[model samples]
Target: MNDTQSVNATSSNDTMLVTKQVHEIEQFETFGGDIIKNVRVGWESYGELNDDKSNVILITHYFTGTSHAAGKYHPDDEEPGYWDSIIGPNKAIDTNRFFVISVDSLVNINAYDENVITTGPASINPDTGKPYGLSFPVVTMRDFVNVQKSVLASLGINKLYAVAGPSMGSMQAIEWASAYPDMVPRLISVIGTVKADGWTTATLEQWTTPIRLDKNWRGGAYYDQPPENFPNEGLAAALALVTQSALAPNFFNDVNAQLLAQADGKPDLYDIQQSPVIVQWLMERARGRTTSMDANHLLYLVRANQLFLTGMNDDIEQGLANIKAKTLFIPATQDQLLMPYHLERARDMLKANDKEVELVYLEGDLGHLEGLSGIAIHSETIRAFLAD
Candidate 1:
């Protein structure tokens, strides 16, 4: 057994506490042919590991999310981890039976969060002792899995019972199944696409345009700017695109309809600069998401996603054939960002390659977000798949 001490991470109530741990690699190489030294990433685990370390289930987090997948950090915290609904004692992920692990991605956007520890553009360069900024080497989905693989290896884990994630996390999961076919035996991809299609890649680029146009962005060298001069507007705007794309219109109608008008009983439409309450709501939603986000990091994330292809292979079919894991796809039917067609293509490709694949749709108006918020509705499906 590994020498690491057991820590309680999965709980159904506030009494359980979760602690963040960091993993460092002396030097790391990027798929794009760049070298980074002293790579560090934060990770957390839920449940206990069995003998031989074979009960491990790796959970990759989505973009805009951290490594906190379940449990509360403190007794009085406002909420547990994001996926608490399906990762507890008797939940779908069933921490009682599976040792679930999650890691923070390199260049994670939530750099300001106290619990997150990641290396990225905001990290100090050991050579120059300054933030890397735009000089940071480009990273991709494959890089994420590689780092995760290193983490698992450090824990003496050579095989994963399952590798599962949603959206960007799903991309990482797919990469794991492809890159290390022998290591991962099961793949659970929720609200994911096989590859970044042309339409989706362009849309992701559009999300970054606001940040690039921001006067304070300064070609991603705005780290020295004071908080007041930070590119909050651009980051918030970019987040708004992500938020709206992940959710359906009903969310706006339900949450922002009453605030659409001014106290004077007038609509917010008289001037070109005056935005409706819904628009302002979007901005505030993004603003409150985490103001410490770096614009350069956002741009890098966009590029990483844009450059993603099935297994990073020139031929998509050959890449799909590399997967040896039994795959389960749970896609949100109303997802706009990664539409049903995207998952369909992946499922079809896996089937064409004679891989074991199963698909179940999540029916909800939350669009892409259903993979998170509406996942519990399909708990039985997940439980059965894991059992299989």
Candidate 2:
């Protein structure tokens, strides 16, 4: 049989078709002492499950991502999921060898994407028959991991070969190893850190500034308003900030003309209301992406990221000491957002505990996003780590 035939994937053409599945919980207790009822989330899986279920790999997505980790739901689609580069038959993740599953986080930023099924501020409150909005309980990275644990339990797969993700997915991966070290044997964190530091926490909070300042946001109560009244502009601006933060200045330079060229081509001296070409370009992209996202959900995600602390509590050192999985961290060499130092700090703490950990740099100018779009650069590294 050919390589594709040996795997659960459809064809050797490298295009796989997958379906989104749903998981529900009657009541979910958050890490912050809040209880959410009738919770449901969307999940998708690729590859075959071994008889012993020992080859399961859980892929937790980044802040703006969904469960569609790889494959196209439709054949003619222009783009696949975010990490399609490294996940496929004979690819780094190699669906032929492992069962890969990715789930949408509660309050996922892509909540409005038709492909995403998540419970967040935009989801209706079972108790009030209204969108949860600001009323939704705060959920942290640990809370996201706990919800994923329940999803795994439902599948009768209690143990994992590895839990991997990029950015915030990195947080969930570390949280999984911390909360259930015995259940996970390997952990992969791409552009991730074990805990959110003070500076990092404050930086994340900046993304929320635009959303709150939009008067139409109406304190996250605009869900019932007219479509035009929704905080689209605010959300768009907020997403622009996020987009700028995720990418490196160098990456932008490669795709767009140099700032000097733009300055000479266009007259910036005439109109004070006019924005720079690069900034305008970023805003347009953000506006398009946020057309389907919720403003309140963006705010909630920022808060959730701010609340992340390895084990979701004090004494992060103790939490680092709790992990049992073999760990690998791939931080972008030029990442300005999470910064490579995030990996260094985690590496130091894990070493203090005598944990088996290794570090690799994702060499690219995409900055923090190198982990997402540049993962192919280190696909072999991931394959070997998982195999070992």
Candidate 3:
């Protein structure tokens, strides 16, 4: 089992499980013309609220990820931590010095947990008493950041030590830094871009297409009576795209070989979990995303990601002027989703703006997966930046 799996088995020993509380914030008239009412926010903190409450570091999670960043669900379990490598006492993001707060994204695929307060197509609308399905308002990266700010405000945290994340989470981190420059002073953006490019947008659209085109989608209302196609096929197709985009080249080949070795030439069922065989399962997990998050939210977030021209001054002589924090732009050289060239561009932009920026090209074949995999490689750099 992976270290995370082993830790999952005995999580309660090293972590605390606060009551998963849901707070109803405000209703938002989304960009897509759908009204999102009583948006619920769920959150947890992994350290004490200091006397000053200034030791807060917001850790945003990636796509297809849950709010369980680490530790045991209960107090009696033996597992270590989820980000045990980068978080905790004396680790990169030492829990001893910093209070780390990780939150779930709105309408994210992993938004079903009790600890995750979210609003999307799958949520039951107070007005209709039915899942919004496709009727939910579309959201954007900026909207998500605004919600997070609301959560922070509710908790009385007016400023942050840093905001960090990988992939989609990274996109939010950048937006948070740019949108609320005075709030976040340190930022770690990994394996992502300020804006999603045409290629990336096409990729996201295709990922959703597999599910949308399935007759089972029933015009996005397949909750009670899904069709035979069930969009599971679409989900699977999307996962294939996800896998290809997230992992580095040849990772599957290596995994396949390892699984075969473990089987010792016998019928090997190892890694079936990560294999294409489980596409249906993965598809089901991604089903019925918030309908209110219409094409507009997608397009908005995509544009937000694609339009990120951080260092470009309207005039070259003006230099880089917008950035306010020290940024660490770490992208995998083999990244398939957000290419390495984007990081190079970011570095130039930050440099132009006279901001302290560092670009560390993660050297790994894990491709986009290097964001997670390469964390260990540059954990020290991150630690030092946090310390600074």
Clashes counted in candidate 3 amount to 27
**Alpha carbon lDDT of residue 189, candidate 1?**
94
Candidate 1 colliding pairs, count: 0
- The digit string of per-residue lDDT tens for model 1 on 159-221 reads 999999999998999989988999989999999877898999998998899988999888888
TM-scores vs. true structure, each candidate = 0.95, 0.95, 0.80
Model 2, CA-based lDDT:
0.86
Cα lDDT of all candidates, in order? 0.85, 0.86, 0.64
Model 2, range 183-218, lDDT digits (tens) per residue?
Answer: 988999999887778988888888898889999999
Candidate 2: where are CA atoms >4 Å away? 1-9, 255-267
Candidate 3: tens digits of C-alpha lDDT, residues 156-175: 78999999888877877877
TM-score of 3: 0.80
Please report how far candidate 3 places residue 377 from its true position, in Å: 2.2
Question: Who wins the TM-score comparison?
Answer: 1
> In terms of TM-score, how similar is model 2 to the real structure?
0.95
